[model samples]
Target chain A: MDYVLLIEQLLNGFQLGIILFLMAAGLTLVFGIMDLVNLAHGSLFMIGAFVGGTLTLVTDSLVLGAVLMVPAMFAIGVLVETIALRTLYRRSHLDQVLATFGLILFFNEATRLIWGPEGLAVPLPDFLEGTVALGAGITYPLYRVVIIVIGLLVALGLYLLVARTRFGMLVRAGASNREMAGALGVNIPVLFSLVFGIGAVLAGLAGLIITPITQAAIGMGEDVLILAFVVIVIGGIGSVRGAFVAALLTGIIDTMGRSFLDVVLLLFLPPNAAESAGPALSSMLIYILMAGILFFRPQGLFPPRGATAAP
Target chain B: MKSQLTPAHAVSALLIALCAAVPYLASALDEPFYVIVFARIMIWAIAAISLNLIMGFGGMISFGHAVYLGIGGYAVGILAFHDITSAWIQLPAAIGLCALVALVFGVICLRTRGIYFIMITLALAQMVFFLSVSAERYGSDDGLNILWRSDFGSGIVDLEDGAVMYYTIFAVLMGCLFLQWRMVVSRFGMVLRASQSNETRVQAVGIPTYRYRLAAFVIAGVMCGLAGFLQANLERFVSPDMMNWHRSGELILMTVLGGTATLFGPLVGAVVFLLLSEMLSTITIHWHLLFGPFLILVVLFARGGVMGLLGSRTTRD
Candidate 1:
């Protein structure tokens, strides 16, 4: 119930939201442009974390690791798309779900085989290690602040890429009508691979940045992947702007719910009962939020152009 | 009428007889493990059959069918925790709770389709999973254990006995298979299958297909719940992991693996899935590594599933 502690928790929530945006943005784009349900998206995030974590360990430099891993992940993304995912574009969603679910099992086991079952942590650079004073003797981790900044920059870059570039226009056109775009000579297959690769890079970047705070572990991407799905559903699938706003909202709501829900519940019930029930209820808050949103706005907050209406 | 039994029907009759004789054979061999494995397979086969009700005929494609299993399992576990060891009360409660959850979730999820339907169902089940994980009163994430199986007294039946449990499951499976066959051939099943084949055309034909699909979803949910109830008693334990997304995937896999759109497809798929797991685990600890690629191969090559492969020459045909 400390006021400062509550504010700190809110900031933590914002940071988490920013990270979720990074993951969700790429997912929304892939789904929007290519009309592909990529369950292997989470695998890309895990791969990024693993690749970044390994590079950081070898180089002993976070900056170098970050720089090198981005392109490395993009290449991996392109390779996966060309080899495995490209063929799936013309298939049904059931096939996509089954194949991607298989990929999850594959990636999880592969990670375990390579990295062992234990989680590995990346050392925060010395310059970014200290806490920043936030007045009244309260301090927050500077590294987290950096993550937020980087996430914001990426979000901005994404907006420009989607809104300004010629490729962005083609993406928008493809999302609206794939056949029409293909008829217009958009090189649809290559375009899908490019969009997928970009999505992979974005997910990988989010994984890399978050690695310093959280451990690099097998199956780390699943939780985040689900959250990203929730964000897209609430934001309106295929809408990047919707993803941004929804991700931030989900992050703040989820973090705040977890941190203060128990204290808030104690007002209505006995302390012991509240303590036990609060966490359980709080964990479900975002899903409830998602349901509520879907109930009111079945197509989401920002329905993408040319997107088919939901049943 | 006697010659009406075709070769396929004769084979099916022979298979049923062999299945009926399994317990006696196992008992004669004194291999309780084989009986137990068969019993386990029957239990899951029932669950998979329930999943197929929605996925195949209803075309709902719910990814959270296992939630009913967890609900059914937890119903038994919770009742046992409160020292209510009666099957009469536990079974109804399990089915009722699962029906209630499905009612609510179906109301919301049936409003969407395709990817949204898949994601929403997954999220709702995850909500249930997180709730179970955080429930300190119900042993939280570790799950709750049953102290004793439901008993019906000396004159009738004792479920505590393994062979009795096995026969009970077999009877339930047979009953469910019969119900599924009846339901699929009924007028309602025609509507559901029509919707799956062509929603626009079904609508053009002046049928309100959404209601039919929703009804099918509820029925499937309730059936899955029954399976969950049986599974809880069979395992004598319940955990959040029972309702996890991975289990949902496995349920779908069972349906698809055995050949979707077929009456006993899920049963066959579940048996194959469990047998594969048992065999693979014995060979290597990282069995999922093999299972994952196998699923991909099934999707890529065996689109019609095992039953489809055996019954049909091509997926589209």
Candidate 2:
């Protein structure tokens, strides 16, 4: 129970929470606005990581690579939406799921084809490199601190945009009641596409940031995307505020549980059994949390104000 | 109720006949590969049929149905690990365990409808997958190998023979199809379908839809577990891969490819999907690159799947 280790793990959890929020934000928005379950959202995340990593290698600058990859990822997202997902908007949720699933396969294999099976790693810049010393023998990576700051800034910016802007109002309206929003002369299709694009950009941002920490692998998106799914579902689909809160909660709980569940379990069971069971139980923590949340609050922690019902 | 044979029923009969005859035909041709392939197909067909029962007729899309396969596979593998390789013990253990898992998970999942249900099921499956992966003693990600198949009795049923194994699997598949057919026409299944089409209406009529949906989910789970048991025996191995989300997606794809709400659609879907991939992979490693778009086209154009192409009315009652 060293303080430094605890702090490091806490920071790790916070960093994970931020990354999850980035992924979950777009998912919640697209789901909230378009009412489409895009299983391939993870593909977009993977594309961002790969594209960002590739651009970084080509440009030899992390900032520039991120800059270039954002729009590229945005364009990819819009293309997928326009080509594959647009036709599915009017179809049932099952159809949307199936179609997006197809997109997932296409993207995963396409990545493997183009990038090869080996994962790419993004190098951190000099300034972003190195560790910062906190009190009590604590040291934190500058990259992770930056991620937390960037995530918070994005959260604030998103909040202001959604709360203070007219377009945001329309997004809110559409999410609440698409028919009513359509009746009010909102260009529903364009708005939906824009929301989807914004979501793609957000997901890409998360992916780009994490490339330095994690290898930009072909199938990386799905692992995080599942957590993102759990985040949104627990946060309540279509609610960004809920997503943000739930994402952080999940990230912290999962990380802490993973790191310390064995220690906690040792108190109850034989040392060998606890050692073996801890990891398994810790891995299941968030899902259990999600199930518990759903069992209690099926609509999620934060259902949009007027819409107690899901779209 | 009609005595006249429809295209759907005729297709089902043809499928069953072909499945039953494949082992013998392959034996005649001395192609053990076909026997192996068909055995794998029958395994998947059973799982797909179970998925179709819930997804098509019950209108519950469980994205993690393959978890039952993992459960069943692991049940056999774990039992064999501890030296309990009896078919009677292992088979029922797998089914019972999967059913129990399904019961607990299904109860919670049924609380949510639509996309939430799908996500929850996926999450639950991932939970099982991760737990299995962490179980280092059981081979975890590497999976466990079963040295011997489930022994039914001394010389009563020898699974070591490929022909016997193939026929056993085929018989189980046919028996499942028959049971599924009977279940669909049964009063319980009628109520399940009714609830699927209109939950509110069914509830207004005083039917406990949740119980029926849970029952369907459990039934599907048990059937898939049976598939898993056969799969582990067929491969003589069990791994977390058997329960991966991708496998579950493939099961969904198979059911959809064949046609949902049709009894034999799963069989058709599994055969086409497995055979196509098997054939394609030999030509190139990037078969998924092509297979991916194929799935999209099927969803986009061939909405009802292969059986729908054969003029079966896949629509719900």
Candidate 3:
């Protein structure tokens, strides 16, 4: 009922949406272009968080850590693509799922081995520590506002790269028809690796930005990754625009549902019954939304034009 | 489908016999630990076999198959919480609930194909998982403990005894395998396999492949629910962890590790995967680091899994 609280939750949802977009963008692109299901994409996000977390700890500078995290994730992405995933693009989806599932295990355990099981945190720099006041006595964290700006900037940058550039044209072509793009002398393998690298970098950026808020921990990528999957699935798997819109939609729905479902349920049920059922129903909100979306539009709201649902 | 015994059939029979004999053999050797291990293996085998029905034979790669196992486990746990200990009631409830869940999921999911199908199933399973996690009446994330095993009502079977529980699982597993064998050779099975191999071609021939696939999914879900019932009886506990996405991945691994599309591949894969995990976990905490790469290698080099290594007929036919 309070407008201030409503605005605050909306901002919370927007911030979460921006973070999910970072993760989902890479996932959609890799899945769209390479036709591979990389379960370890979450592992890449975890690795970035760890790298970013560790770099910030040692150097005591957030900007340098941010600068290093992208390249580190990009390098690891290229390495994984060249070593394991390249051989799997032509394999069955089952094979891709299993192999990448294995990578998730390997990455999680490797992180535990290297960093120990204890979660590592990155402190907020001095300048970005304060909160900003909006109208109606509403206040929001400056760091979260920065995340929104950065996420939008990245989204715009990706849109320009994908829509305006020659390479973006090739990516579009590849997503629509891989064999045709390859036949057109696109150097398909390198293009695949580059796309993969970009995807990894994007995931890494999400991890780096959020580590200060969420803490860098082993297996953190997985929870976000599942949400990212929901975003892309509801958005249309191969569409970046879909991922962006779906991410924000999911984030808002999830945030608002969690915070307000109990109050809303109180209107329909007795107080005790509403109290007990609200949390469970709230947790299911996004999935129910996803199911409804899939039921109506099986290919998602914004399926990439000319690309078949499966590929 | 040939009724005559072949080399693969002989090998499968030998494996089943070996499984049935494990408790007896371990008793003679005075190692009760092996009984527990084999019991766990049999439970996992049942779940894996059900997964194979959908994945290998039906060509519907459901990534959330383990949710049935969780649903089954939770059915018994919830019933026991409210003082219903009879196997007749608890088991039926588990299977029925699993069937209903599968029907709902299959209806929505079968509308999509390939990766979309996989993601939708995963999302739906996660939905149930979150629900379980929020259910404060149950133990939620900590899981619930059943005070007593399913009461068979003065029958010769007493699950309180480890051997009885083990044999009960063994009998159910064998029954499932038999059912699977029968289904795979039946007219319906042929339609399911054909649909998996080529959906358009089958549809062009006038078969409603979606219905067959959905039926296969439901059957597999119910079978997995049975496994969940036995698992709760074995451990006396049920948690959302049982149906976590990782567990679903493990089911897929077991099917692939054994060699998909083969009759006993899931059984074989479950044995190898569980045994390897048990052995590796003792060495260090980083066993998954080793196991992960090994899984990748298996996918890369050992494409057909353990049964494929034996080079027998890959499919049930």
For candidate 1, what is the interface RMSD? Answer: 1.4
Tens digit per residue, CA lDDT, model 1, B36-66: 7877777778888888887787667788788
Model 2 misplaced regions, further than 4 Å = A308-311, B1-4, B315-317
List candidate 1 segments past 4 Å from native: A270-273, A309-311, B1-18, B204-206, B312-317
Q: What is the DockQ of each candidate?
A: 0.75, 0.77, 0.84
Task: State model 1's lDDT.
Answer: 0.84
Clashing pairs in 3: none
Residue A310 lDDT, candidate 3, scale 0-100: 60
Q: In order, what lDDT does every prediction score?
A: 0.84, 0.90, 0.92
For residues A108-150, could you state the per-residue lDDT of candidate 1 as single tens digits? 9988999899977998889999999978878899998898889
Task: Record all residue pairs in model 2 with backbone atoms less than 3 Å apart, i.e. clashing.
Answer: none
How many residue pairs clash in each candidate at the backbone level?
A: 0, 0, 0
2 or 3, greater by lDDT: 3
Answer with 1 or 3, whichever has the higher DockQ: 3
lDDT of 3 by residue, A173-270 (tens): 99988899999889999999999999999998899899999899999998898899999999998899999999999999999999999999999899
Tens-digit lDDT string for candidate 2 (B1-317): 23345686787787778888887888799986897898899999999999999999999999999999999999999999999999999989998999999999998999898888999999999999999999999998999999999999878578877778888898899889988888888988888889888889999989888889999999999999999999999999999999999999999999999999988899999999999999989999988888888888888899889988887876463
What would the per-residue lDDT of candidate 3 be over residues B177-295, giving only the tens digit for each residue?
A: 99998999888899999988778999999998888888999999999999999999999999999999999999999999998988899999999999999999999879999999999
